[model samples]
Target: MRLTSSLLGIFLALAALSNLRQASAEVGDDEGVSFFIPSGHDTATNEDVYDLLRCARALRDEGTKSDGASKAVASAIAAAVATLPPIQLAHTDHTLHQVPERARAYLPAAIDLLARIRSFAIAPPCLDRPGIPTTTAGPYKYLIAANLVNCEAIMPYWILEVLRLGLLLSGNSMVLAGFSQNVANAQGSASADGYLPHISVYESGSKDNTVPWLLVAEQLWGAAGMRTFVVVNGSLTRQMVTDPFSGKYHKQHRIQFLASVRNAALEPLYGAPPGTYDNVVFVNDVFFCAADLFRLTHLKADIACGLDFEVWVGHKKGHMSGITQRNFDQRRRRRRLQSSSGASNAADASTADLTLHTSINQMSDVHLDELVRQMAAEGRIRNAPVKIKYNFYDTWVSRDISGKQFVSDVPYISDRRTRDILSKGMPVPVKCCWNGAVIINAAPLVNGLRFRSGISEKGECDSSECSLLCQDYRRVGATRVVVDPSVRVAYVPWSKSFHGSLSVGVGPRVPWSQVQRSGALQELEAIWNDTKRDMATDCIPLGTRSEEADLEKVRSVDLRLVNYTQMFLEDRRQPSQQPTVPRLCNLLMGPYGVVDYGTAFDDLRFAALGKNTITALTYTANSTVNSLQFTYGSGSGNVTATVHGRPFGNHSSVVFQPGEHITHGVVYYDSDGVIKLVLTTNKQRNTTIGGRTFSTNMLESGKIHQAVATPCPNDLAYAGRFRLIAIAGTSDIRIRSISFLWTKIGGKV
Candidate 1:
């Protein structure tokens, strides 16, 4: 809320500098080419047209050397200009590739046609909309057209388009969005360009939120490297579930900080800075981490100017408000639910609903929490690192055959809700036509708080519609919600850590000289189970209140949850140990053992200790060499192997087990070159690799591993250590007789 006068001075000075850059227009400077079209009216003169023409020429020339995608964009622009009626330029719906058939051929000739337009010197700056001024004024009036027909908001659309094109050509798929009207240069320093800003953020209709964007200018004053900025309107308030900053300060501050943090992470590309390389983040303590930005960011631009005269064409309709609002509400509600549940807030259950309906009710809850949510001023002190995962599915088909019967008659609606919601604001839904699109939204249910949508009779649902209704009933700062066309949700599993673990075994195992039917493969499986079972027993039980303080701290900070489940797999493929007499085998297997270890399974029977419960994990590997196998059997029946089929190959695969513990089983190992296994578990508070500590469930339990009874504690034996097991038959063979190493020998058992 407080800003230094010196900072303010810097802001004003930057504004002036930007204004001066355009001062050439008044002085009859006609050297630059313009991208804008000029007005023929008497108020507009040839001088303006000339300036615009110069700017356009300059831009075209800039792109002249562009290759691949960039060249394609420029060529498309050129082609569109040559054949499409000048009036057709007003149609917002037309992308460069969507021009008339005759215009298609003109694309190759576009560059030359554009060059001619630039020659006019008095050409008008291209006008995308009315009112907003272009970078330079002239034939291309410098006005930006909205994304919708007859709309007037400018700047965002044009800037975004340019950035989008640049990104395409650069091959950076990461969607970098800008906010506000300031331009941060390639050197990281920022300066206000022009006030052609359509986005206005007001704390209380007094101070503009745009002031914070200037923070980038100050922070990057002397830094170097690519600086990105994104400006979006729909206030980044708590009302919209997609807001990255929905805490105390304001959405503006949150986005500013988000950008700064992301820039810091990306700065590695520019080389590290001097000391500590703090690379100060200007978020004002609101948003933190790139994950937040990635999860909540949204992009929108006005498009009316492009379709000014094409109103009659349904294809050129604006974004629908009904659909937009619906999507916004649903997203906001989900956010509240996630925050409350993740943070374990003690607020009354009804408070979430009240928050959800804040805007609709026009109620005020501007307390610190509410303020933080609205202005995006909250710090990392009250947030969690939210993990978002995206899943893609065909709308016409369901994974379940039962759901398929209703697909045709059900009017499958993947983005129909988005259409319905946006219908309130725009003339049409831009999303209805997309397939293979990615839809990003809040996770379905967070803790007890959830954002549930109304299901249709045929099991169809409309998230956009439900969101709109919910948001319409709430009172918050944001006007509308942001919904990603991408069909990905911010996934927050009931369990934070994953069970899939990779163990890297380094010790030696049985060799293939002395042969048996099953060989040492069974022993290999036992060692793996010993490592896993020990890990499971030693971990804190799920849902227990152990280490509450540590958990609180984790919850309060935005630290990413680490899952070191692949270390074992990577360690196996590491360069082979120097071959030696008694060889690597002497180091792994016990002294008098001739173990022919291959692969084996196990179903170790164990009882739950203290509060600890049984945790089942399956290990998989792929290589030319053999490893171990595990199986369980009783006095009355055949021993059942804990694992099924071969686990390791080329692709990722999941290992499944019935429960935490089984009746009886055994394990075996081969000690061959291969040891790449994907092990998954269901035991709460139990996650480890080769018996080494990786991650433990937040819950607390008092269980200890059965391996602890041995001299080599499970923790110490599996701690980044594994053995190579070789299997021959049902017997164990020592490595003393084998001549070949693991990788050199490959054959199917």
Candidate 2:
């Protein structure tokens, strides 16, 4: 019910003047909602004010009875107050319509409860003034209600938030019990610990080594009314262990220990104070995340001081990096367990399981085709993308197997045929001809992208022969020396061509030295002598006769040499061998041949170029490829395995690469003959039954090992059952992947 101001005013005025408070306290004084009641205005005396409180309270209790009863109660109160001599009276508005009738009885009870509440109150010089500061035990504004009342108003406004901040600020903590001791310890400890005064009762630990844990504790303790009834949420303990990476001990632990030692050494100078603690602090050693600790803080603060406080031990600047660190270590440890236990062998796995893989070459088609069909039959292909990379040239080359056109403008590619090839029950060797045998001139093209093109020439350079020499230009239809497109595919630039030279054209089909000039040679020799006589002449100038005659004989010999060169050129030639295509087997199966390590579990992330990468083993079936499976567990003990996917009729082994990001599952097989899988992260890890960590370098070569058998609850054909256990002291642990194989004809391996 809503309280009317008139009734509130009567109680407030009466409470202000009543025996429940001195002459200056306020409303509900006896109820522990506030400090000393307002006893009076300046003119009011102690007894005079008591009468007002008594009268107001009576009016409140009478509320509104039946007409006769109400009149009778009101008459009685009026009669009692009227007996006193007239004084300047603060009015109590007694309008019964606004007051609830049920409130009528509480007036007497308030008086009775008043004496009990008085037990908690201190003797006062309390009413100094409004807005005056007060100590924890004083009648200060915030402390007014706090000092007299049970914790109500103070908790909602400030206490809880403070404790939450404290826990985060200070990792160390101490929980003390009871009211009297808590107060005694707070008063004494404040003076003894100077820099880091123990705030007492509640706070989060600060990671800052410089901020003494005591200072935070002192602030928290001092804020409560010098004494609060606190319950033991937990004890302060040193984190004795060191983080291997940091190589540092817990700094807060050392400080706390020293403080405790000092407190023990020094005794309080004053008499026995309220809340003096015995065995007040102790060292605690356990590691838990700040997020986890926050919950504890809330629970504890609510009880102490009636304030709701939240504690977070390792949270800093609103971030929980410590929790994240713990999670990461868990995943790494789990992977280690899978590898050492040989949990990935699929051939030995008994139940149906689906495994995934990344990229596999052409030979993989033999098994992958069946694997996909089996996966589909099991209805497990929820999300798989068909990835395609078109090598245009492969299609170009294979367009016409009949060799109709030796070369086509269109590029050959491994396109539609790729789907067709992979779709078959068996894998086909890739066609190895121009596309596979010849290496495309990619280097020059790449270089061209980087290089700036030279400026184009305006005109061709002058040259006598266009065919023989690379003249700067050539006429249309003029045969010129150039690289052939077909030959360019097989050759790098600046190498020897199919035939030696572009030109072979110094032939005059001479019928055996026709015009073998003996006489013309003599006459011509004489003229040659005359011609040689004039050398270095713009206009023909003749040299001296003796030197001229010798030059003439040399000139005649030079002409004879030029005449015999054409005859030798016509006599030389060699036949060139024709080109042929290469066989398919040599190209499809690489130099050492391909090994299909059957599919392990994967998300097919390998298909994407610039995303999370996937690495796994590729498996191919030699004969009728059949069933595949694997198992895994979370702990080193016997793991419960469950199978997924459909079993094939032919034998197949599950393959997986250990260090890859995606292929994590149970050890390929469990004794139950089911494929097991688990979840794991960085913080909580799996160790081998012997406790060995898995390292990346050790898995260079693959191993297909045997699995140890354990009992199954029931004979199961698929992922029928599994087990999970709670870690004793930690919150980090899970499983990731598994691999194994089961064959029908063979005894279990």
Candidate 3:
């Protein structure tokens, strides 16, 4: 894709615009983004106009790559981009009636242009982008805008595009979300105000296409009539350290540079004018989107945030398929414009997919990009909620409101009140959080606050710059900082979709009150009454560092489980003879293998929770829990028993007392599957199952979560909350995993 004569001319003009913008040497070479007002001479000539239109025509190829109606489009507009304009014209009105034939060319474009913009130098930017949603609930009756958009610590360009589309799409999403939030706005359908963020990037020591892509993005944004600033501190030296004139650092310099890179991203905010922008969103190298930007902007807090997750499969090339199954609750979704008809707010929930194709785990960039695009087009990535699976990666930066650090496992928020609030889909207050992305009010920063290093003299631990920003926020009376559990992000785009990603509404803030039931609010007295505070490690400890590289042995999840098994052993009655038994809803858990994408029988429930007293447990074990069967006691006594795995090896039964039940249990196994299981009863009765002999590798295994209730990936229960029932794992001959299902006997936690 070499630059043509026209595109080469665009390069020259774009280079000129770049020079006019804060130049390469405009700031300290050591750090900081180039932030400066555009000059009067930053205008394109008539030649560059044609090149833009040509590039746009090329980009908007709807099907197999071919030239679109570029010539006609260029002819239609009389030098629209050749010269700058003074007064911008208004677009079409919000009407249920049909649009007039005359105004069709720029009806929606004008509408978007009038909101939060003067002009894109000559015309609205990026006409090649997917057209704006034709119909909406109404118009932009409310004004929601962010003049500054911030990004830091980036990797590949595909991940970057996810955010780019997010910032670009925020213009309309904010308006739509706003109208939905305000009763008057939706009713009035008043067309006014929108979003247009000045995207800024700060990168350091990257050996990839990030900088080139960013440079091109600047050109694209400039054509859109928006401002962009990019600064890449790329240097050839990898091992160069020992403070060489503040220019290059790495390795031993890794710890020092582990930091400065973050602070560098904040440099642009330092010299901005007060009230210039409503919010400044700071995102790390995590996957995010336009929906993310829209959700973060609407939160009622001084700082609103989203968390990140990381997952990797120990995959070897074996025709491994995509995620077999994941489910979600049904809800109203704003689908794109229907054919001829307006956009429909489709109502249906798509199960969030972890579609990191195991077979293609080591795929090339182009192939991966194709997969990413295909999956991204589906509903899976758009509305999936966030939840911790193995590790909540940002433990160091994320802290409870009381400044206590979170755990390293799933359901990371340990504070019951905080967890309850988060579980209820509210923005729970936090001392600080930088899980992945955060939307912050730059009013304090514009006033004096800065993202800086820790001060040892102030007793602050050497922590992230985000912690320091929160500390400054507290000092400036901007302490309503919270993390929305719905807004989820991950290191890989194929990972979890953010939490709080739904039809954007201005939901109430973290409601602190009396907690007696579900969605109960916690009391805010402790937060309000106490005043004195100090910077400590408990609140701002170390940044999260995942051990996937070192602790690879403990990490094992069967990505091949394809059967979406949901069944019941009995419908509160034995089908063969008994009148009534427990209504058991069994589900699949752990790395349990599924066969042929179908369950063995119609009444199959793989992983189920029950408090029923197991009168007897039988097993045929060679080494692992090879084949197992169990019977529960009732008024009629032990009636029928259920069996899992093969009926081979030495058989034995461990009977329980009258009132004994499994309080908690532990399963020890490996790639060979369920090797052994020990159920701990309420009366300290321990029933051990499986063979006495096993290897060392299987000993150091993961635990089956005790507080797990829901089958949904995003929703999880708490520890000591749900009791284990009957585990119906081992569907296939090669059952390689087992996890304790910790759910209530009859309901979800």
Best by lDDT: 3
lDDT of 1 by residue, 1-749 (tens): 12243653455345434433333232232112110112111121234233323333333333433343233333344222222211112121223333334323324333222222222111111111111111211111011111111111111112222222222212221111121012121111112112111111111111332223222211111011113332222121211111111212212222222222222222222232332111111111110111112211212111000000001112222121121110113344335333423232212221222221222111111111112221111111112132211122122211111111111111222234323322221112221111211111211111111112222222222222222122211111111123222111111110111111101111111111121133332432343233221111001111223311121221111001221112212222231322233412222122111111111111122111111222223343333212233332233333323222223333332232433322111121122222122122223222222222212331122111111111122234332122111211111111111111011011111
* Tens digits of lDDT, candidate 2, 110-135: 22212111111111111111110111
lDDT (Cα atoms) of all candidates against the true structure? 0.21, 0.20, 0.38
Model 1 alpha-carbon miss at residue 372, Å: 28
> Considering summed lDDT, which 10 consecutive residues are worst modelled in model 1?
302-311
Deviation of model 1 at 733, angstroms: 27
Q: How far in Å is the alpha carbon of 213 misplaced in model 3?
A: 1.9
TM-score of 1: 0.18
In candidate 1, stretches whose alpha carbon ends up further than 4 angstroms from where it belongs are: 1-92, 96-603, 606-629, 644-646, 649-749
User: Candidate 2: lDDT over CA atoms?
Assistant: 0.20
- Candidate 1 vs candidate 3: the TM-score winner is 3
TM-score for all models, in order of appearance: 0.18, 0.14, 0.41
Q: What lDDT would candidate 1 get against the real structure?
A: 0.21
RMSD of each: 30.4, 45.1, 27.8
